[model samples]
Target chain A: MENKSIEQLNDICSQVRRDCLRMVHGVQSGHPGAALGLTEYFVALFFKEMTHNNQFQMDGKGEDLFFLSNGHVSALWYAVLARSGYFGVEELGTFRKINTRLQGHPATEEGLPGIRIASGSLGQGLSVALGAAQVKKLNGDDKLVYAVMGDGEQQEGQVWEAAMYAAHYKIDNVIAAIDYNGQQIDGPTEKVMDLKNLKAKWEAFGWEVIDIKKGNDMEAVLAGLAQAKGLTGKGKPVLILLYTEMGYGVDFMVGTHKWHGIAPSDAELANALGQLKETLGDY
Target chain B: MEKTLDLKFTYTEKKDTRSGFGDGLLEAGRQNPNVVGLCADLIGSLKMGAFQKEFPERFFQVGIAEANMIGLAAGMTIGGKIPFTGTFANFSTGRVYDQIRQSVAYSGKNVKICASHAGLTLGEDGATHQILEDVGMMKMLPHMTVINPCDYNQTKAATLALVNHEGPAYLRFGRPSWPIFTPKDQEFVIGKAWKMIEGTDVTIFATGHLVWEAVVAEAMLREEGISAEVINIHTIKPLDEEAILASVAKTGCAVSAEEHQINGGLGDSIAQTLIRNNPAPLEYVGVMDSFGESGTPTQLLEKYGLNAENIVKAAKKAIARKMSY
Candidate 1:
C-alpha cells in the first residue's frame, strides 16, 4: 500500500462508516453495529497497516492475510475490500442480495474475493486462521495471518479451543484482534454472558495480549496493530482487545446493543448519513 | 447372451475396517507428501497411530476439539495440503456438523473426513457413540461425497482413493472385525457400484457391513428357487444412479440393507433414486426408528435384524410386492 497520512486514513474511515450505513439500510437486514464499530480497524488494516494484495488471491501465499472471524460485519469488510481494489466499488449494493458474492456473512462458496473460509457461525475463524498460519510457516512464507473476532463471540467454546490450539502449537505468526465494544445483540456482553477478565483469559491461554483503549481512533488502531505485529515470532500468538464504541460515528446509534443487527429506517438513515461524510465519495 | 458371474469369495482373516483406513492412510501419505492427518485424541481408537508415527510433523493432535479439527483441516487445504480428519462417526458428523457444513463442505475444501466406529456395529458403545444418521447428514451437504466401504480391503482402497478426488468427502467405517473378502488391489471408484451377484428375481443393494450380509442372503435366496442380484453400494452420495437404475430395471424389485437407521441412511437414498427414476417395490433392512443399546456386535446385529436372515426376509417381501404390482 502507498503511504497515506493519518488525515487520509481518517477520511477513509469516515467513508467506510457511510458505506456501512447505506448498505445495511438498503437491505434492511444486516449487522450494522459491528460494521460501524470495526470501521476504523478495517480501514487501518486494509488501507494503512496490513501488507495485503488487493488483486484478491484466494490462497494469499507470500502475503499477509486477514480473516474476519466475527463475520456479521460483512458490510465493513466488503467496503474495505472493494476500497482496497479487490473488486468494483459499486458492487457494495449487492450485499446480502440474491446470487451476489457479497453474502450475509463472509464466505468462499460464492467465490468472494479475499475470503478464504466461510465464517458466519461464531467461533470458527480463529481455528481457520491458525491453519493458514501453520501452512504459511510450513511453506516458509514468513508473512503473518491476521484475524478479528467480536468480544461477544468469546462466549463460544470453540474460540477458546482455537486459542489453546494456537498457543500449544506455537503458532507465532497470527495476530488475533477482538472488537471489544461491550455490546451484543440482546444486551451488553456482561449482562448477557459475562466475559470476566478477558485480558487475563488471553494471557492465561499463553498469548501475548495487547489492549487498544481507543479503538475508534485510527492512529491508535494502526499503532496497536503494529504493536501486535511486533509481538509476533516470540514463541507465542498475539491477541488485541480493541476497545471501541458500538456505532462510533453515528450519534444516535452509539454505545447500545439495539443497533447491533437492526438497520436504520429512512429517517434514521438520513440522520446517520448526515453524521458520516462522503469523504472518498459514495460507492 | 449374458455374462454369468461365478467367482469364489472367501476371507482367510477378520479385521476391523478402521485398520484398513489406517493402512490406506499410510499409503496415501507415502504417495503424496502433502497428505496430512489430524485426530481428536482418538488416534488409537480411530487407527490413525501409524500415519502419526510415520509423519509426526504432518500429524496434528487436535485433542478432543472436533470443531477445531474440522476448521483446521479446511484451512490446510488452502496451502495445497490434503488433510484427513479422524474421529468417531458420531463426533465427526453430529458433534461438529456445522463446522463441516460451513468450513469444509460449503467452502468446497478438499478435506477427507475419515470417520470410524460407524453404525450399530460399533457395539457396546451403545446409541451414544454409534452414529447411524451420519451418512444421511453428510450426504445432504451441498458438496460432500459420502463413502461407506463394506470390508477392510475396500475401506483401505477407498481411503487411498479420496486423496485423488477433489472436494470434501466423508468415509465411514466400523469398529467390529469384518470379513476381508474384497481383493487388496481392487480399484476404488467414487460413485460406481460393484455387482456382486447376478439374478433375475430381486436386487439387493447393501452398504457398509451389510454388503457381506447381502452376499449370504443371495445364496439363501438361490436355495429358495429365487435368483438375487447383489449390488455393493459403497458410495452413498452421488448415489450411482446409472448402476442403481440399470440393476433395478433388470430385477423389477429391490431390497436395501445398511448398518444405519432406516429413516435417513442408505435406504432413504436408494428409495429416493427409485421413486424418481424407476418406481419399484423396495424393502428396507436396517434399524427401524430406534436407538441401540450396549451389546456385542453380533448380538446387536442379530437383535436389530441386520443379518443375512433379515435381508432374505426383506428380499422376499420386495418380491411379493412386485408380484402384487
Candidate 2:
C-alpha cells in the first residue's frame, strides 16, 4: 500500500520496460510495441495508483479492479504485476511459454495476480469494469474500477454501448483510459477506422473527457489519474484519451505496425537491451 | 417408446419461461441479498420487472447492449454476487459471443446467463430471433454449464438453482408457454435426468420445449402398442451421461427431441455420449438443417418437424433399430 515517489515509479517503469522487452524476446513471440509503450501507465497502477494487495485473488474483496482491454499489451501488465509482488519476480521468464500463468493474454483461470477477467479479445473491458464499479457501490466499498482500451478497439459498437451505460447509470466509480497510440495491427488507427473527433464523441456520450501524454511523462499521467480519482461519485464517468507512441521506449520498434506482434531476433534483442538500462536485472 | 420425455397439463394459462425466470429471480433475491439481476433493455421482456421493482438497488438495467450485460455479469461475480443476466437467447449468445468467451466462461465467473426466446417457439419474430444453435454455442464454452428447461415451472426452478451453483451457466428457455407438467416442487438439479413416464422399449432424450412433445408422443406410441419412456435431459453440457446410459441400458434404443437444430445441440451431446458408452440405436427428432420462418409457435413446431408426431415417429424407428441390432 506504499505509494512510490516519482523517482521510484520511474525506476520501476525502467525495470518493467526491460522485463517486457525481454519477455517478448525470450518467447521469440509477443507484442513488444505496445507492451514497452504502456510501461508508465501500468507501473503507475501497480506501484502508485491502485489499492490492491499482491495475494492474486481473482475477486479481490474491497479492492480496486484494473482490466487490460487491449490485452496484447499483456507484457506491460505482467511485468508490473511481477515486480509489484503478485508473483515471484523470476517468473517473468516463463511468459508465453508452455504451462505458465503469464499467458500471452491475461486470463483469470491462471490465477494470476492483478487480473480479474480474460481480455485478449478487444472492446469488452469497459463494460466489465462498469459492472465491478456498480457492484462496489452496491457493497458500499467505495473502491474504483479502471479499464484501458486501444484507440483502434474503440471502433467496436459495444464500446459505445458500454460508454452510454456508464454515463446513464452515473457510474462515476469507473474510469476508462484509451491507449491513443494512433496505430493498430494493420495500420494507423485513423487509416484503419478513423476515430475522427474522438473528444466530441466521448463528450457526446456524457463522459468527462481529458487528453494526456501517457507514453513518457509520469507527472502528467499522475495528474490525469488524480483528476479522474477526484471525479469519482460524481454524476458523469471520466475517459482519459492517453496519447502514446506505439513503441514508446524502444527505439527500433517505434513508428510501425510491424512491431505490433513480432518478436525481436537475437540481434534485435541485443540492440534493444543496449538502449534500455538493466535497472532491475534480467529475469 | 422414448424415455426422456414427460407431460400432463396442456392448456391452463400457459406462462412464458421468462415469467418463471422473473418469479424465481424475485424469490432468489428475497432469499439471498447477494442475488442480483441484470437486463439489457429487455427488463420487461425477460420478465425481470418484479425483481427490478422490488429490489431496485440490486437490479441493474443495462440498456440495449448484450455485450456489456455479459461483461458486467462476469465482473459482478468477482465480489461473490450471484448475477443472473436476462436477454433473448440470440442477444445473449451470438451478439456478445467474444464477451462471454472472455469475461464469463474462460474467466470461470459464477454468472447465470438466463436467456429467453430460445427456439422456433419465439414465433412471428422469424429467423432473426429464433436462435436454434444457442445450445450448441453455449455448450462449446469451456466452463459454461448449459441448460434448457422445458417449461415455465422448470425454467423458474432452474433459475433459482443456478444461484447456488458456483461457476458460469447458460439457462435457456422460450418466449411462449407450453406444457406446465412438472410438479412445482420438483427439485431442479443440473445434469440430472427426470423420468416422466417409465417405459421399457425406447428412451427419448428431450430438452427445452420438446420435452412436452416427447410426452405427447409417448401417449401416441402407446396407442400403437409401443411402450415409450420419457426422460428430461435438462442440462446439455456436462451431460448426464450416467442417466442416459442407465435409460439406454434398459431400453437399448433412443430418440432425441428439441426445439433446436440437429447440429451440436442436445442430440449431438447425447449421440456423442451414446457412441462412447451405450451406443444405442438412435434417431434424432429435432430440426434438421434449416432456419426458422415467420409463423405462430404451433405452425413453426409442425413445419420444422418439432412436434409430438415427429417424436413418435423417431421413437418407433429407434425401437425398430433396436430390434434389428
Candidate 3:
C-alpha cells in the first residue's frame, strides 16, 4: 500500500466518499456532509501521511496517532480505517446501530481498532493530541501526533485553552488540521459565530498556520499534510486550515449547511451514488 | 471489635489534607515512573509544588484552564501515563463537568482528578470557589470513583491507593488545617468502610472533614448514654452498602454527616442504600439547600450546621426516630 500515486489516492477517496454515503443511507441517519468533505483528507491520512498500524494498540507508543475532534464524520473515518485494514471493510455496514462497535460517535470501549478516544463532544481533540504528543516526547518516540478539527468547533472555549497550552509549552510534535467547510448545525459558521480571519486567529494563538486552498483535492490535501509533517519539531505546533465545501463529490449535497447532518432519501442516495463512482466494492 | 474500641484516639498535630495530597503525589511519582501531574494554575493552592519540583519534566502547569487540563489528562492516559489533575473542587468539577464526563469517565481513562479546597471550608474565597455538589456530579458519571478522604493521613493513604486502582477516580480533600487522626502507615482500601467506632444505639456515617465531627459526636453520644457507631465513608460512589446496612441493622437508625449540600452528598447515598435494602430512620447533617458565604472554616462549619454539635443533634434525632418507630 506504499508509494501510491496521486491518482490512486484520488480513486481511494472516491470509494471512501461512496462508503460514507452508503453507510449513512443504510441507517437513514448520520452526518454525510462533513463525511463527504473530509473524504480526501482521510484517504491521504490513512494511506500516506500517518505512520500508524492497522492492528491498533491502545498505548500508541511508537505510532503516529490521529484524533478526530470533529467526530460527526465517523462514517468517513470508519471507511478509511476499514479500507486501510484496521478492520474488515464489511463492518462499515454497522455505522450507527444497536450492538455495534461503530457508534454514532467514535469510541475505543467497543474494541474499535483505530479510535483511541470517544469524540462527538467538540473542541477536546487538540488537547488530547497535545497530551499524547507530550507523552511521545517523554518516551523519546520521535513520531508525530495528528488531530483534525471542525471550523465551527473553534467557538468552544476549550479549543483556545488547548491552543494556548500547545504554544506556551512549545509542543512542536503535533500537527493539527481543520476542515474549514464554513457550515455548522444551525447555519454557516459565519452566521452562527463568525471566526473572521481564521488563519490570523491561529497565528495569534502562537501556532505556525498553513492555509490549504483546496482541502477536497486529493493532491492538495496530500501536499498540505506533507507540508504540515515537515513543519513539526520547530518549537511550535502546526495548524492547517484546509478550505473544503460542506459536502463534496455529490452535486446536490455540496456547498450547503442543510446536508450537514441529514441522511439522503432513496432518490437522493441514488443521485449521490451515481456521482461517487465506487472504485472499491461496497461493504 | 472490642479491642478496636479500646484503642485511644489522639493526634499530635493538625494539618491541611491538601499537603498530604502533595506528599502522597510526590511519593507516587517516586514509586511509579508513569505518574504525571497537571495543575490548572493553582499549584500552591493544591499543594502540588513538591511533585512539580521533584518531577519538573513530568509536571504540566495548564495555567487557569481546567477543561483543557482534564482533556490533556485523559489524553495522557492513552499512552499508559497515570495523570493526576490538581485543581480546586469547584473548577475541577462544576467548571469542567462536561470535559471530565466525555474525556475521562465515559472514555474510561485512568486519570486521578485530585481536588483540594472542597466544600464550605474553602474559607474566605466564598461560594464561587467552594463546590458542595461535586460529590453528586462526579458520582453520577459511570466509571468514576468518588473519594472524599478525611484528615491528612487518610487523604495521603487515599492518594496512594488510587494509583493502584484502575479507571477514573476523583479524590476530594481540603484547604484548612484539620485534626490528623487515622494511622499514618495504615493501608487504605478503595471501597471498604473504615469503622472508626463501634456501638449499637445509632449509626453515624461521615466523610471528609465531617468524619472528625462524627467522631466527636460519637464521644458526645456516649456521654449522653447512647452508643453511636461511627463509620468513615471515604469512598462515596462505591458506598460501603454492606457495612452501612450492617451498622444500620445493629443500630436501627442512621445519621449521615458531610461538609456538603444535604440533597446530593454522603447522606443521600446512605439513605438510598438503607431505603433499598433495610428501611431505617435517618437524619442528615449538612448544608440545607443553600450556598456558602465568606467565613472562617470554624465559623462556616458552625453556621452551616456541619460541626460536631450538629452531628450530635442529628444523631439524637435519628435515635429518637428509631424509638418512635
Interface RMSD (Å), every candidate: 0.9, 1.0, 0.8
In the range B1-325, model 2's lDDT, one tens digit per residue, is: 2233333435455678788889989999998999999998888889999999999999988878888888888888877789999999999999888888888999988989989998899999999999988888899999899988888888889988887899899999888867677778469988788888889999888998888888788877877788888899888988989888988899999999988899988888889998998788889977798899999999999999999898888888888888887
Residue-level lDDT of model 1, residues B1-325, one tens digit each, is: 0012222355778999999999999999999988999999999998899999999989999998999999899888877889999999999999999999999988899999999999888999799998888988999999999999999999999999999999999999989998888998799999999998888999999999999888888877777788999999999998898999999999999999999889888899999999998999999999998899899998898999999889999999999999999
Candidate 3 CAPRI-style tier: high
Better of 1 and 3 by DockQ: 3
Residue-by-residue lDDT tens digits, candidate 3, B278-303: 99999999899999999999999999
Stretches of candidate 1 off by over 4 Å are: B1-8
- Model 2 residue A49 CA deviation in Å: 1.6
**First chain TM-score for all predictions:** 0.98, 0.97, 0.98
- For candidate 1, give the lDDT of residue B304: 96
Alpha-carbon error at B49 in model 1, in Å? Answer: 1.3
1 or 2, which is superior by TM-score? Answer: 1
In candidate 3, what are the lDDT values of residues A2-94, reduced to their tens digit?
688998898998999889899999998999999988888888888987788998898898899999999888999999999999999989998
For candidate 2, the TM-score is: 0.97
TM-score of each: 0.98, 0.97, 0.98
- Of candidate 3 chain A, the 10-residue stretch with the lowest lDDT total is A1-10
lDDT of each: 0.90, 0.86, 0.91
Q: Report how far off residue B89 is in candidate 1 (Å).
A: 0.5
- The TM-score obtained for chain B by all candidates, in the order given, is 0.97, 0.96, 0.97
Alpha carbon RMSD to native, model 1: 2.6
Best candidate according to DockQ: 3
TM-score of chain A of 2: 0.97
